[model samples]
Target: MSYAVTARAALFTLATALTLSPPAQAAVSADCTESSITLPPGALYPNGIARAADGTLYVGLITSGNVLRKRPGKAWETFFPGADTVFASNALRLDERRGLLWGNSPDFLSGGKARANRIYALNVADGTLNRSLALPAGEMGNDIVLGADGTVYVTETRGGGILRLRPGETAFSTLYRDPQLAAPSGLGAAGIVLLDDRLMAVANFGTGKLYTLSYNDPKPQLTEMQLPRLIENPDGMGLAPDGALIVLENGILSGQGRILRIPSPKAAGMHQLEVLREGMESPVNLTITPQGCAFVSESRIRHRLLPGHETEVPDSFRLYQLPLPLTAAQ
Candidate 1:
């Protein structure tokens, strides 16, 4: 090859690297001072976040939006492209054992008006949409999590409670249903970590409480715990490495959303937990890295949907990285 060809090739390689490198890693990871959620083509209120085994972050851009995936130390990538193919309620979970992601099909936004509001699965390796699961009565399925045994548990908020779907079973059965659960939006299950075995937790945005239930044996009991403060719209949930639960509260009434931490996830019968950060704007989605860095996705849509008058969110998409001290808290 000539010198000119080699020079052009070198320049092309450098450009590629720059595009893939994280904004902070460009010079320093700590240099990430500007926090923003870069919305994809159709992501207005993008929700649902899951981290793969390889540290890649997969987010649900619900309301017929694309599923956005961001590999660690890199910019976001649009692996799947289909409007509302991934539904509402930010239901996205990386099935660690099965190596697939389960997302909800809840319809809350205007874009998701015609959606079926079901559950779908995708292979992490190829981003191919595989294994679609429909909801029962399809009462707008929302958040979901997988048990250690590969059993898929989802929160059917509009349907009133949690639904459990075992492996190879297409249908589901009601695990817990109560009027106390106003809106069971986000869910996380502790299989091996909790002594109660299938320790499932759900976030109720309407009530601002984190309700936990245990499947010790034949019967399951439901318990509700209020939030530290009046956090509006507690949307997505992510479990930190140190076993603490990280909640992304969308402050709709207060016009703010914040990342809150609840220590002692296994400990039950608690009134409320604590909030680590405050004054966030519509933080709808959250994902925890292996290193315990909490990445929150903020969408200022709530501020726009005001009474009589309305405007689109003009803020750039943001993802804040918070170094949570979960281990030290423990």
Candidate 2:
């Protein structure tokens, strides 16, 4: 169905139930990690997930119109929503210092001349609503990333481009506006150590293509990575400390959803491996910690640990997690 329809259902169905729960607490494995915590009853189907410098998980729900956070050993908290000063939170990003959490407003949820999608900067320490950045209205804010120097890059859905916002600037300029990013969806910046050079990759939600920028050349060159046909709608992306690239299939057309792992995007005989997990209904974003923790968020569920796939997630939607590989890059 269309985004609006799904959102309406999400808002109405929210708070009616917990939706999903872990199979157990001590389980460990890519397919069996139990959930440490489940999202609130009203949280919408979550999409993009970003971790704060403090290490809390920030998940954006496209329908429920809020960004939910889960602290280590604590229950999930819904911080910002469309009802507040700004708008509904969609895509997510973090400051270079990991101090702030930013979520995109993706206009698909709210129709208006209102500032398209906005990123609400959240304080990880207190779960307080901080500042917000606004983009031109009607442009769907997809995924976002911060450069080493702290420049912020956000992708636009139908705008078919990426916008660059400096550390303290409000107005954003398109970094790359070609059709290749026709549906510029998910985005993540790789540390120089991860890809030999600081790079940023954006997934095309519509084209099933991968776009990469080598470095900060005035004009960023784009490269494409081929994927297995099974992963047609590439949504979000994550990188482990060792540089392994983890991709999430963001669409829910065929069945529910799927998560795929590619050893490395550096191209060294690496093949796509499908990660078997349940409750993936529609996996949006993923974050791999240096400690071997793979945190994933479904369109609706809160953040959970890897091997969290076995948790009892609703067939309609859910999230999963697994232990990241120690030698993920080599």
Candidate 3:
């Protein structure tokens, strides 16, 4: 099947499952203690999560384009109401310095009628739409990472490349493109994190491969990183406090979602991949706090992706918090 056909099929299946399913309240996992927060009622498929410095959280929903916000001890509020223009919010990153919250809002979840993808910048203070950039037709904006020099980089899941929006630029330009970045399963780059000014780590959701992009030179270099073992659908990624790579494996199809910590990803052969936690329910994205806790958004996509498992759809999704000890740096 062609990439477009396969993608449409997968999306159609998910939509059918969701239509057949009825939401029910489910118990939290034993590992999810007081730190985990339940998503607001009626929120489904929480795909992206970003944390503010003041103990506030911003979450983007996949089915609805709504961006929800939660303060330290306050009820959840709709930061950005969902609209037809902003269809699905996949990944989010908070640019606190610039007072913007960047997110990828694709139309894939809008009944599989894929249209132009969108990357939006919202005012962090009041959740007003600051700017919205439309990607070319047939491109799916999946994940986002902001550069130190005010550049915005987004992963094209269907286009199998990276798109860049430089400072003072009105439109995005192709930063890098390669056929190998995509998998036969139709999904391509899903997660990305800036290592420094020039380096970025990206995860391939369909192939479960990891790669590093060096964009210092005129021609950017994309090098696949050899891993200790095959990762099961790597989804979202972030940098730890001590500069280690922290990855979330969605494992929605395999039913083995987990989080991993790679102490030295550049030197993969020398360092072992530590499994921090396992058995999560389709964790799609994560954001690390300054105090060393990782907050993961459990998307629970399996309930909507698997036909027979639709009844398992939970009434409320959750955000899990796992403390990463400083000793993990070693």
Candidate 4:
């Protein structure tokens, strides 16, 4: 089925029974260990994360559309506030060379406002809007990744395609689209990571499948990766320095979220996935630092999506940092 059909079903579901009430406010859990950074009270649902070279972290909230930032030894502060244009922020990518942070602002929960989905670029030094590029009508922007040559790539969850915006280009063009990228029910492409200028890894949220796209030539080749077993709800992903694939399985309704590490994802044949962490609330996205540490954002969206769980939304959110099991040769 096409994304349009699935999106209509999702919107209808959200409109009727899944409309959630305001979450109850509370304090951060005392069990939040030192490895985790607690978000401010009522941070809502955080979905995306980006880390800078200086250890500054940026997190994007899905429901509130606010972006929070934290320095190496400071508290989390609001970097960008929700606005009429940016109603929902999804995935985030940092373009360090350009000194910009790129994010998706989809109108997923805007109640059929027909607003164009946006790919926003913000100044990394300060949370100032650098540009807001509108996507095609009916396209839902989901994930973002920057190429080595300053090209920006985004996934269209509702359009079931990859969109590209080259440097100095004002409008985006469709890079690749296939039926495998679309879901019959829920979201389609949810996470994306560029392995290099020629290749990218994409995860399907609805199908829980992984695919690698090679854009070296005019015709991009999409290949389904063979995995050892079935995965669930792959949301955000990153490429480890050691060539491993780090992914988050955000259990939107089932509450079975986890983080997985797949060694040598580019290798041929079946790849074995190792569970690095499990029993997370609703992990959404992650950003890997050069020092082999990964910070994961737990959106906890199940509280809003599941019936009778509205009050279960935590008062504060969190970003947990985990050390990647890299080789000792470094």
Best by lDDT: 3
Candidate 2 to native Cα RMSD, angstroms: 9.1
Order of models, best TM-score first: 3, 4, 1, 2
What lDDT score goes with residue 128 in model 1?
A: 80
Model 1 Cα displacement at 46 (Å)?
A: 2.0
Candidate 2 minimal-lDDT segment of 10 residues? 7-16
Tens-digit per-residue lDDT, 36-139, candidate 3 = 88887899889879999888889998777899999888999999996667777668899999999998887653455576778889888778889889988777
> Model 4: residues >4 Å from true position, as ranges?
1-34, 111-114, 328-330
Across residues 12-75, which tens digit of lDDT does each residue of candidate 1 receive? 1111111111111112235233355465554555666777757777776544446788877887
Per-residue lDDT over 36-150 for candidate 4, one digit per residue giving the tens place of the 0 to 100 score: 8888887877887898988888888786568888887898888888676776667878889989988888764434755778888888877888888898877887888888877
Each prediction's TM-score versus the true structure: 0.76, 0.73, 0.87, 0.87
Give the candidate order by descending lDDT. 3, 4, 1, 2
Enumerate clash totals for all models, in the order shown.
Answer: 11, 15, 0, 0
Worst 10 residues of 3 by lDDT: 12-21
For model 3, which pairs clash? none
- Using lDDT as the measure, name the better of candidate 3 and candidate 4: 3
Better of 2 and 4 by lDDT: 4
User: How does each model score on lDDT?
Assistant: 0.58, 0.56, 0.75, 0.75
